[model samples]
Target: MGTKWITFDLDETIMQNPFGKWVFPEIVNMLKKETDTEEDILDLIVSEHLQRMSEERFLEAYDWDDIITGVAGNLGAGSVIDIERMVIKHSESPKIYLLEDNMLDYLKRIKEKGFHLAAATNGYSKYQLPVLQKLGLDRVFDEVITSDSAGFAKPNPAVLKKLSDDGEITAHVGDRIDHDVLLANKLGVFSVFIHRALPAEVLAYPIDERATHPSFIKICEEKWHKENRLREMPFLENECIPKVVVQSVEELAEKIGFILK
Candidate 1:
């Protein structure tokens, strides 16, 4: 057999979007001019966006302009907002942090174990490249494959197949079952689901517990519920299922070590 390889999903698997807290509030402010209540506007926009993302068909279609326009139309706002400006502003500020404290060290150890590492993510290189740099992981991966560069996205096996030309992909690890796990399964590779709990900071949106907005609290609760529901749902025979599930980088390292063995 050729050298073994292991692929990882970038967002939410190894990285956390610390800047996501600003997105909802900024969007709420932008829509406030067209709407009366900021709370209702926030709730409606978040709910609509999440609903779209939950659908499998819309997985690769993350067009914020379309999503924002749809939300505005639902509110009878007539698409007055400049969505292109908003998307550009947020897309450029792609800040990310490691999901775990020891993630960098763990990745280094994995590299030391002689397995080829690849970042098989569904994002533009313009955005993901800077994130990897910021986290000091730009040089860690043997390959960093992005949707923009690969001409496709996960759960398409071709994205991962690009890395398998000279090696055998032993396993793939990611937080999303729909994308990462599905992609791994398609390639007949072991899938490791990393189920990290939502951070308290993300849940503590609007940043003030004393003046907590009902809409913010509701959104957080609904997000938690949806995450749990996705995890508990039964996978159909046609749907992809992970070979193993892990909750932390420690468990992930152990699992990968076992796979390599």
Candidate 2:
């Protein structure tokens, strides 16, 4: 057995994206349905604005008048084409996710342990990278594999293979079993599940070990979806499963500390 590399998911495992992050899909779904009410289309933004404290601060700091002008200018409000400034305003409202408490420190520790790190996420690189940049999250990983960047997304061998190459000791950490863990298993790397708030009965596989504290799923409220929870999957018929089932990165370092030796 060789030393392993560690791969992490972005939104739930290491950071808190408070802007109805999971519900973005639901909002997009409304757009897909072509809902008539601007309110209905933008309800997620309003709901999140009223809910998340970080976003409330973002709203307060934004120059409302400048925002209005920007929206008007960008959409060409007076042009022959139609415009929905109200909906646009809600949609563009500085949606953001911040670092988990001391997560940067944890990441640095990971690097110090001499493990190669990569980010294996299934979302927007354009949107996601900015969040990472804001929190210095970008510094943690030597590589970042976004589904979009990889072209085929998660549960796909192409996306997983980007990190799997070069013989790094790679393990996948993600909230979605279907997307992240299952995909990692397919690629022959170790897997770890965060158990973001999923019912035990709901899982497709028994999580290698369940995290009791700092349940990352609830911390992000994405626990309702499969995003916050991570399921450490067992080795497939041709793969290997990691022995460590730790609550935090610190413990992961300790359990795998021997690798450094």
Candidate 3:
């Protein structure tokens, strides 16, 4: 094979998107209950977003108790641990989005062709595997590697370098422009940018490929349910790259084939 292996970013590329949005509303309610307020939740939301926007330390994952107190104080929620309990109890779901259609078939074909697949993500394997299991991509991926696993995140060439030695063709797919597309270019892999959970402004950044279809969509209702919940990351059509831009995994697979063959 010309391209012996391919790497992937886990969060928005293959499964449901996670922007901490899911936990926002519940946090607001918790703030209100704890602080005793009939006020709208927007204050709480703005407070939280600003709080973690690079002023103080920002974390991808956090404990329930610390977050509640900080957010409550920021938004003037006033002593709300019980509400924190409510938010923690129902804040997140391990079950996330799955693939769209015919994508899984394409992966099976690639696997039959003897291509290697690995997930190089910024999250942890333990947390991400559950998400993959929910999407059914967990079992299919030959190797699963993450920032938590590797001790670093995207835009870092070291993670991509781990996929293969020099002289082998590698392809990377992901949703973030700055993190995925830009980094892959530097790492010398055929890179794809996904618009699943992005916005027009952010997506306008150029990527080697603009992907429109899921690489591993399955037909099961459980899979479909997850797809429905995928955060709508969008992009501008004007985004361009020196390489070919494609909309489906079949297209990506073909590109990899030509390069590797």
Candidate 4:
């Protein structure tokens, strides 16, 4: 099959966002201000942060005020409104993103291989475009389309169709299977999922030699829920499992190298 275009997701795929990198410290301090003594709230903060990170759709269902109200009540905070303000302020911290280690060089090598590159991410163009520039990728992508610009977001056929209409065979890569892999499979394009690594327990089992067991989708869903059970699994149709799952950007680069070659 013809394949030329290679698009990527932004946040976790090409960048690393440390746990509570933006809000944890501010939230802790804000809570401490209302109480004379600090309570053991770090676990609560981490749980809330992980919920926000893993449950993408759940966050949109409610506003920050609602989120803060629930979190404050759970934490028994002195001021709900004040905590809400702090939460909103810290949410903006994602704007300060750091590129993955040697990701620039890795992407450059792909470009040198003559494959067209693009970024298809879910966010407002106003915020997303700056992150690319900050990561020195504004010029790297031949095209960068945001949900706001496209009038749609990931897992939306409209966005994928728009990219496919370019008439270049294409593949989309990302860390999340429910979005990236499902969308690629729906469009009948190559699906390359880049997982960081196998779980410690499963690491010993050779992926190639393992007997029939849980699907990758199941494995990821379990981990996702365990880390953030507040949100339900986006689990789309199992019919669209990724054609390839690699452990790192380097492994993906090598696979892409084969495709381009």
> How high is each candidate's TM-score?
0.67, 0.56, 0.60, 0.64
Model 2 lDDT-worst window of ten? 79-88
Error of 1 at 243 (Å): 2.2
State the lDDT of candidate 2 residue by residue for 1-261, as single tens digits: 444578887776776643354334443443434434344434443434323222323222223233333333443343221122322322322454433466677777877776778887765465456566666677778888776677665566676565556656467766555555556777766666554344443333323333222343343234223322233333232222222234555445545554333
Model 2, 123: alpha-carbon shift in Å?
0.9
Task: Residues 25-144, candidate 3: write the lDDT tens digits.
Answer: 656655566667776665655555445432322223223345556656766655545533343343235424544466666666666677677777766454456556555676678778
- Whose TM-score is greatest here? 1
lDDT, residue 190, candidate 3 = 69
Name the lDDT value of residue 48 in candidate 3: 50
The model with the greater TM-score, 2 or 4, is 4
The Cα RMSD of model 2 versus the native structure comes to: 11.4
Q: How are the candidates ranked when ordered by TM-score, highest leading?
A: 1, 4, 3, 2
Quote the positional error of residue 30 for candidate 1 in Å: 2.4
User: Over the full model, what C-alpha lDDT does candidate 1 score relative to the true structure?
Assistant: 0.65
- Assess each prediction's global lDDT (C-alpha) against the native: 0.65, 0.51, 0.53, 0.61
Model 2 TM-score? 0.56
Q: What are the candidates' C-alpha RMSDs? A: 9.8, 11.4, 9.6, 6.2
> What would you estimate as the lDDT of candidate 2?
0.51
